[model samples]
Target: MPPTAHHPAAPPRLDLTDTLVLFDWNGTLVADTDRALRATNAVLTHRGLPGLTAEDFPAKWKLPLAAFLRDLGAADPEAAEQYWNRALAAEPAPLRRGTARMLDTLRACGARLGVVSAAGAAAVADDIRNTGLDDRFDVVLAGVAAKTSALLSQRPTRPRAYYVGDTEYDIHCARAAGYLAIAVTGGYRPAHALAAVRPDAVVDHLDQLPGVVTALHAKTPAPLGGTPA
Candidate 1:
């Protein structure tokens, strides 16, 4: 079941002087849903599996990606890897709306930024470079099979840490890693789908992110096994 929102009023405003904000790649920071779907369908056609519609893609998409491929009839890791390679070879997706502004705002406000994604490191790095966002992030951790493990490895204790993403999986990963979860609606999933995951908050645009992060950081950090405040 989706967790209920703990705060229903306007998102509070506060300082985020030394916070670390981590982002997911595909649907979070990059507007790649269309390109991703096209690549996915191409792979499906090549593998003799049924292709998915745009609506079906978000509702059914899963992470580690290999699991999604296996469900689509990929027999082994090598087969899934081939499909992933093909997807990467497809035209790159554009940056999401307000992505650059958001990064710049956070940087100017003294927040540390990073990316932790399941996409290949080389591919993500290349995209970051091409998009002119290379200097914005302090770390770019990619090819992550499970975000929770990666989060733990980077920051064992989640003080002033936040994970901004677009899926229920991202919310789960954030919660498991003890980081504040912020979901944006402009990604692959719709607003309601993101709300179902019960992140700390959900915003319709990236421009609203700074306020949400500030508010969450002002409150007491949620304990390891407790709900966020």
Candidate 2:
């Protein structure tokens, strides 16, 4: 059986608790990225644009749906915006699991929190508010526009940071911003895909977050064998 990780790693273990933990909204904390994709593709296909199959979806995951549509050959910006708006009307279900408890745990531990996702501001803010998880974060940076910039913007005040997301793009964003990138298998991508990046740590469950954080700041991380951190 896989070893269980129930708590955050202790100090002298690298005080990751001191660093603010920034998360990617869709996959990291909640499980709505797939729902968004389904909604998006439905509209795209109906509007005469081809929908993305799972194989091609990965390539477009990090990019905003509007931008992604354009990249997929939709030259009409107005039509793309309308397609996204139609998807939004459906209001995809959020997969927020143990989110409240998890947020409580992070706060009790004295760690700061932030959310950096490709999700738009309206969708991100709406979900955070609806879930009542907004209070848990010191910063909630969403929307494709703010994805990488949010982390870079916060680094001056909170130098020690960790980015938690489900995609390789999130890790790429983290690396670009110089923060520890922690990927969760629970999100958009599978463990193998996220593992390919060799993030500071990879978690299968939301509850394992503390341990993930601990490992990030850990002086010696059980020898991360995949990609460089």
Candidate 3:
């Protein structure tokens, strides 16, 4: 079985000023799965396709907005994107449970934080500002159609880095960028799907991040020059 949040890993006492931890938005940091599903269904219906049920949303979700649109049989992906954006923006999505605690814990540990998302730039910017988290992240990359390239550019020389997200594609991007891939459950993908991708670690909740960071720190080699990454 894959290692889970059930492991009694203690929070690290070491300062993590050199560690760079990046997170995916949407279902990972925000409790917006239902909101996303509503938007997707709206897009599908607009394209004359059958809407996906809540039960089917997880199975249908995928990265790179264009591909997801095509998978749903959208003939004009660009038009479908506009439909999705308007639908998603109709209501505000709340932060995921334990989001504040997890951010606080990681910040207290002195880790540099960032958010990398495939969502629209305007929507992501509005959400961060609305949630009062605009100042929290060191970097925020939104509307990232080419995620692996964008992520690689963000950490060109950092020795030890981590990317936490809710999907298998996120794990693939992390691996491509040479960051430790940490998958969180209860998001867009199920534990089984995420496990098949072989992320370095998996957790059930965001609050378990401190322990995950602590555990990863012990395993990652110490960075050269001892400077903040």
Candidate 4:
């Protein structure tokens, strides 16, 4: 497991007692970075680019993912997208440890849950079903090129909504969409790397999430789009 950052003065610790919680599928809930890396390397090799090591992948990964591909010699965005989709389709990754427990805890606590992922709808749905979490999410937005767009389209009405993920991109998307961002470590990026983006909180394991959410909710008043002072 990677290090976890717990900044006492992080922003947007909105009350999530009745919040809508949106999750990013890949690194947030699924333990599939290794599988994803392998698939990516396959595509890189196919395109005659040098393969990336696991450690190198996270440090180099970024959103508007086309930029990352371009850095890897994928000059054609459409072709790169196609290759990535095909590679991922051939090798889908599995759920992380304690995924079901975390979902169950949130659901039991009455959090409206959803998943917004860059993966295709069918793939995300299939993974949810395979993991026995078929009915967990109220909304499942997949193959989202821009997560902020998807999030804004939802127009979440709750005073407290959160986007939980494991990358700096996730934090940016969450903030852009007016949701509190919680970045988890032990996924694609290291703790310090995630901390650089200054998410609301960072935890090493999903097991710690319920307590974090509860504590934040308990301390904060319900104000629409409230930011920490």
Clashes per model (N, Cα, C within 3 A): 0, 0, 0, 0
Q: Please give, for residues 94-192, the per-residue lDDT of candidate 3 as tens digits.
A: 898888777776777777889999888888888888888877888999888877987887775355688999999999998888788899999998888
lDDT of 4 by residue, 1-229 (tens): 2235342321234333467778998878988788778767877888888999988988887766567788878878667866776676665577877778777777777677889888666667767877788888888998899999988766444667888998888999998998878888888777788888888777777877777676556666564463322
Please name the candidate that would achieve the greatest lDDT relative to the true structure: 3
TM-score against truth, every candidate: 0.85, 0.78, 0.92, 0.87
Candidate with the larger lDDT of 2 and 3: 3
lDDT of 2 by residue, 95-122 (tens): 5566666666666777678888666677
Better of 1 and 3 by TM-score: 3
Clashing pairs in 4: none
Candidate 3 weakest lDDT stretch, 10 residues: 220-229
Evaluate model 3: give its lDDT: 0.82
Weakest ten-residue segment in model 1 by summed lDDT: 3-12
| Candidate 2 total steric clashes | 0
The regions of model 3 sitting more than 4 angstroms off are 7-13, 224-229
Task: Give the distance in Å from residue 100's predicted Cα in candidate 2 to where it truly belongs.
Answer: 2.3
Rank ordering of all candidates by lDDT, starting from the highest: 3, 4, 1, 2
